[model samples]
Target: MLSRSTGRTRHVLTISTLGLTVALALSAALGGPAAQGRAPAAADAGWSSASPFAAAGSELSGTVTVPARRGRDTVVKLWLSNARLTSVPDACRSTVTVRERASSVSADGRALTCLVRSTGSRRTISLDALVDGEPGQQVDVTVMVDGRATPLGARLVTPGVPVPQPDLRLLSSPDFLNADVGDLVRGPGFWRPGRTANSTNADYRRALDTILDDWRAERPESVLVAGDLVEGWWGTEVDRSGNFGPDRTLAQRKAALRRAAATYYPQWKERFAERGLEVHAAMGDHEFGDNPWRAEKRRLAPLFEKEFTKRFGRRADGSPRYADRPRGSKHELSAYAWRPRPDVQVLTLNVFDATAGGMRIRLDRPQLRWVERVLREARQDGVRWVVAQGHTPIVGPVRSHGSSKLTYEGGAHSPLWRLFKRYGVDLYLSGEVHDVTAVHRDGILQVSHGGLFAFGLTNYLLVDVYEDRMELDLRDYATHWRDAPDGTRLWETRPQGMPKHLQVSPTPFTIGTAVVDGEGHLLDRSGILEQYTG
Candidate 1:
């Protein structure tokens, strides 16, 4: 039951009862430094086109078009309905191929990599190609599937335009428990004996793969994850004890955390790398043990945070993982900032500060000072957009489901938000709510979204950053799940066990969309987010 309101008519197609598809026709404008104010020639009218591909005995039918067009690279995206693939095949194995007809145009030297993934009954194909031609020249592109040629689309190269900067397509989702107990159970045999095989079911994997495939099709420059990358019970043995007895020494507990980190971190990162994605992740409460931080759990928080830093905050040589971090700060690795584009700065905050008082869901003094410095520097550097992400929301009365409902210590009037208001940070992204809520205050927009994937409430946000404006699209997919059997423990923290099986709808449609100008002004808003704009 995923839906959207775009303020314009949209066509929804139900493909073979597998999923829903929304057809959108958008025009492409000339981009790049030189093309800043130049009008796109009429020949670019078909820079993007969605044409149906129906072949005999073909299980796939949907739109094929060039969704992204950079200076010399064009990304063609193919959406197929009711198509199921046995495995996620490389782009070379895909039946889809792109051919360009222009004298000066030739393929870029890089090898062509395509990602073909099947989720539920839907399938997605993404192909990247270098289309080199003179500016203003019309390049006719055709997509061939199984040797059947279809007029996929055409685009015009702008004259005198310098090589375009990398496209600014960013995809984000939080509370993504990419790990399954089944994955851990298959690893180093650390669990207690006689444990059943609790790996993720095939259906769940398929749904996840499909979602990843869609992300690939979008051709994002980077992916941001707010936190909860795994169902981390790490050092604790609440559900299934390790080979050692339940009452272990401090050293034994530390060793357990290392083993768990070694097993899960690589796999979690591989999911993004294999799809050719660059990800910037923040640490969630799950990284240091789930919420309700009792005395014993609090004692192990530092150990857990160390392991997390070793994996995410540092590189192989023990240097910091992120180049742009809060210098001289204690939480430098956990809290960092980077500029994906010259005009945009993105910062990831580690809000879980394990103080002597308890686990305080607030940025410590060092990190808070660092945040203000970064924002001040961004303003001085003329950065157009500043987006900050943490694990929990700072504004409230938000919805929650299957979560601890942890918010920042002081809500909207907190020091963290006060700094944001002073510096004019455009957006704040957070998760841990297991639901979606949008709040706008003091010229800043806070979006709390992302769901427990196992529970079938998952969603993702796509931000398209342009020269003068940014578009945010919040999309949700329908999912179905049933109760898992007893002893199905994904981790020790969750009282409710993981779902036995989960299936996601093939179609993921937009639930909300918004537009903002360079000055942090809300230019337009629609769908579910419209009500929150005031």
Candidate 2:
């Protein structure tokens, strides 16, 4: 079933299981305009269709739609279904290509062709139509299936005034702990028949992928991850027998840390890229060798910080990746800010300050001063939304789930929260607790959420930033995890190893929601977050 909403009315078209050929034949017999390669009339509620096409003994039905008054970011959606091609034995072997205005739509900054594999009899393909044509011009869309090209439809729409600040859609999930997979550690670990080394649980990857697919379906512009992208026990040394070996020389430990970073960071990055998501990440404690930073681990904090900045802080040309940063500060790369739009400024802070004593979870004076300048400048520049993200929550008494519950030293009374209140920063997104908590204080809304993927409490926040208000929907995926065989070691931490298996429900449902107007006032809220509003 495909549904299009226009004004107050919604038009839905339900395609039957009779297959594409039957549907096309029925439409032709009924004299539907869509079968004739023309745009649907206004009564069709902006839905246009292409003549059905069949290939490789399979049939496909599709539709294309564009808003009547298009803007700079014109969104054209193409929905395809009833596609059954020759099945390949591999996990995924099918490709679907969509073209708009004679040019292939782009995905992941490349061509808009999607590689898909079928898991069921029916599949739905939703694509973003990248149209560059001028307003008042007809935009034509075509879909290529196998070797067949079918004209979806063409529609003429007037272009509206260019929007200075378009609505923004974002997904925020932190503590993604995307551990490495398939690396088998051999040694004298607990012996189980099929158990080998403690790599990422394959079952967990599938469950995570399911959640990622749901995010892709929403077509968010970007994803904001507050921290803990990996399980980072890199600096710790373990013998082949899966036992912690603290006697390794500093050189050996450093080499192992570097090797682990090289091995795991790419996997962490590729997961998001594979889903066609652009991620903006903050540095978590794990990136700096986890918390407590004992004397030995403290010595390696700078190296871990360097590795993180090398991957996330700089562009290909060696210039800083963020537009605004605290120049001359050691954390310039790890802590930075950027404006996604004219109305919104986002800052990601590296709150883990490596002191001679130990690691402190606080924004240092230098970074704090930079943040104040940035926020003051943003307010002066008329930015409507300022969002800051870090690993630990500054407003406390929040929830925790399978987490160390590391937080800023001062909690709500911290200098950072005070600055946020002074600057009227709209939202502070943090993730250390691994559970969802909402604390609105002093005009700033602090949301502490995101869960441990291994523990199966993985959740995310979908935020829609409109001109006058922002809507936040907190979604949680139900997952089941079981203990691995005894004696399984996962690198340095989890000597017995983490859960070897995780199973996630197919659907993630909204557990909490809130609406905040431009003035940072909570207009309404529901579910687990409502209690925190007052």
Candidate 3:
């Protein structure tokens, strides 16, 4: 259902290209407005010949048509032009805007950006109208020119049939591991795994097992792991040089880290692969280095970038698959999107963008603005839920694992957080908070969980998204683990408890019971209901 627009088209005679010519040409050629490409069904939606609209110097009216498919969201595309159409015209002299009839979803501002490829290029602008359709109804679309309120009339033909249910049932939340996903050998014979990184592969492995075991029953199609694939945090290191001085120099350390990453990353991929789960990982704090590594990050940062780009697939230039970056930015793979359901989108961010705000974790302007644009486009696409995941928590108790200051929150004050709240994001997922709890903010919820040091306890959140509200099942596993003199840690079932620091929450009721806008926050404490206390 698209929102209704009114009025008649009366185009302005004088074309205003005062300072827009160069920018318009460059942006179009570089694919800014059309970067995403033509809609899947653009060709199927034909357009009528353009004719001069009444009371306009160069306004040519056109009609857009599409096969009406019932219950489905129909997107119609049309080539816009300012002059009379000699052929299937799409180019226009000034800006063009399209609006549709009223519906459940609508785009804000809803203006289309028109552009030219070269200085005097002749290609027309492609504008798309995504209509939220109703059965047996035709959506009237109005195309306005040069900031005109009234539209040169166009119509949308839809099947108006109800769309089938999006065959989506599961979206897993296993926060993966910290600085390392494997056992870290330390000390003379090796102290091992939980000494400094704050976590062990034992806990991660045990958590993975429990998560997969639940997966056997839940069978999630896509698993959304919240970063920290393997611990290369604090850069890479080698066994101390002979008697315990730093073994590798900065250059050597980075190389060693890259080499380790080349090997360990594939191993990490195998663990998730063996479980047969499609994983979408976000960049976490540990993925770069230890907390406060912001200062020294540049020394070993490229090692992380190389591994990340290699794994996630990116151009050699090191930009993301789908984002525009700011000047002087590295354009790394810190932010990306995953669409699990037709109406739901998962937007992930790397809160450790050091492009600004020295040493503090912030989204920065480029990424922040990119997120705002993405959310805006998502609204135009009729996406119902936008679940944003990042490394640090925007709002939470800074107790053991969370950002300690406002600069890190990315909440109301930060442009990124304000954008999220403004766009009405349903859920904001984060890590760094070892505890598996959900916090309610202005209108959204921040939920996080990860395995604590060793195999003491791990929290995996299972979000079940429905058409109306999202529900969550927080799984806590208190693993049985022991360390051998050989330094290999093992998981057992008789440990029965963890140290005070690694203890799981005692209050099961509020552990993962969260709702958003009286929406997703409603959850039953499964541990209590099943009478399985950790």
Candidate 4:
């Protein structure tokens, strides 16, 4: 009977630039002779006027105004974070870089971007050095650009760390589950203190406030809410006496969700904007609507899509709804891919669509095919690792008779499990079980973020993927903080195994149930099950 959203947005600030040269010295001068008048105040500078970077986050964009004496060719060297190191030469070109305390120099340019840890409370982003020659040859050095001094002043990093995985500091409640407010009675249900409070009122403001404070202390790069951002399907109906009772009206649910989004998501976005922290997101069951494949649920798709477009800033035509882009918006109904750093390529799949909002999980034929396409592309492009994230746990420790009952009994594996296995998916992250569980089945790692806003226990899982190694940190909310809670260390798995590496498997392991023992047997667990009716 469990349901929740899977995946999250892990923003990678791109350090794109052109022109490259050997390391050059940065002049310790301010506002070079090119300045005819006083430079803009710090407040007026685009950096301060726009959004601020996260704790160790910073962004810079400008052409290196070097003297022509170096050569007819002008090059800028941009050093990105060290963690982005890859076996592929220049694999990090023009893409978002996701690492801390690292720098990148453009292969052909003189721009250098780095995210250094905060000294005291301030993080620094500098055009540290300018190089204007070959890799091993001498190059001219210029510190000041257009009257601006080199290594610009460091400022206070806002919003601090991104909340994706769990740390030892804060706990995250599973968010994207299509749970009714009533089901969360035993724990700290996230409800707003207003009339608009209904099924969609997740008190993210209070919850995130707590998480943000903890991040300020620990300084994580990003935060991940996983999926099920909204309860678009609360209006579905069944029986009144059953726990899956008469659902609310679609209008009612929509209004509640709308209010909740209007009330908090903007603030959340603004908070992220202020810190220049990239907010990573993934589609959940609720994002589309419960039982998305159902004919009735399909009718609601437009409405849900509209709301989603508005929040994510996409256009009506389903483009990356960037304010500066166009009339389009960011609408990813199937699959979206990203790279945390040059080494990590994350593919977010809309797995719920396979069920089409019905009782069975099936990978959309297109997405199933696309998964292979994206993986091949990433590998060809020299991606060091590939991680797939979705909302449902295809494999876990929970055992149950497959039932569509509405209260945490949907514990059977989805057909996509084999697809994941075929791909040798390194990490499968999901939320719905309402309890944190990490296990390795057939060399693939499955992590359930579990549920939050219940029994006063909320949590999230953190994962750090290094070269040939990874670290999983699970953070649960401490009960003391009503709004936010403490996080407990749940479990981790980076065990040695057969080259579960990124090599593509010709065939995925079959999707079936495994014996409680480690027999590695496949059971006929296909198809959605009915809810557990005691």
Best candidate per lDDT, number?
Answer: 1
**Alpha carbon RMSD to native, model 3:** 22.7
Clashes of 2: 0
List the global CA lDDT of all models.
Answer: 0.61, 0.61, 0.45, 0.37
Tens-place lDDT digits, model 4, residues 197-221:
2222234334444554544444445
Give the candidate order by descending lDDT: 1, 2, 3, 4
Candidate 1 vs candidate 3: which has greater lDDT? 1
Q: How high is each candidate's TM-score?
A: 0.67, 0.66, 0.54, 0.45
Q: What tens digits encode model 2's per-residue C-alpha lDDT throughout 1-534? A: 011011221112222221222233221211211324444422211132442221111112233222223222222222222211111111122111111221211211112233333343333443322223345444344333332333333433334323223289878998886343433333222323354454655675687689788888878888999999877777465334322223368876776666666666666777779989988999998888776678888898889988887778877688778868887777878898888889998899989888899888888788889999999999999999988899998876787766788988898788888888898999889998887888887877888888777666677877778777776767666577777577344443434456777788775544456766788887545445554432
| lDDT computed for candidate 2 | 0.61
TM-score of candidate 4 relative to the true fold: 0.45
| Candidate with the greatest TM-score versus the true structure | 1
lDDT of 3 by residue, 390-425 (tens): 766676553344332222654557777788778878
lDDT of 3 at 354: 45
Angstrom error of the Cα, residue 281, model 1: value is: 0.6
On a 0 to 100 scale, what is the lDDT of residue 468 in model 4? 38
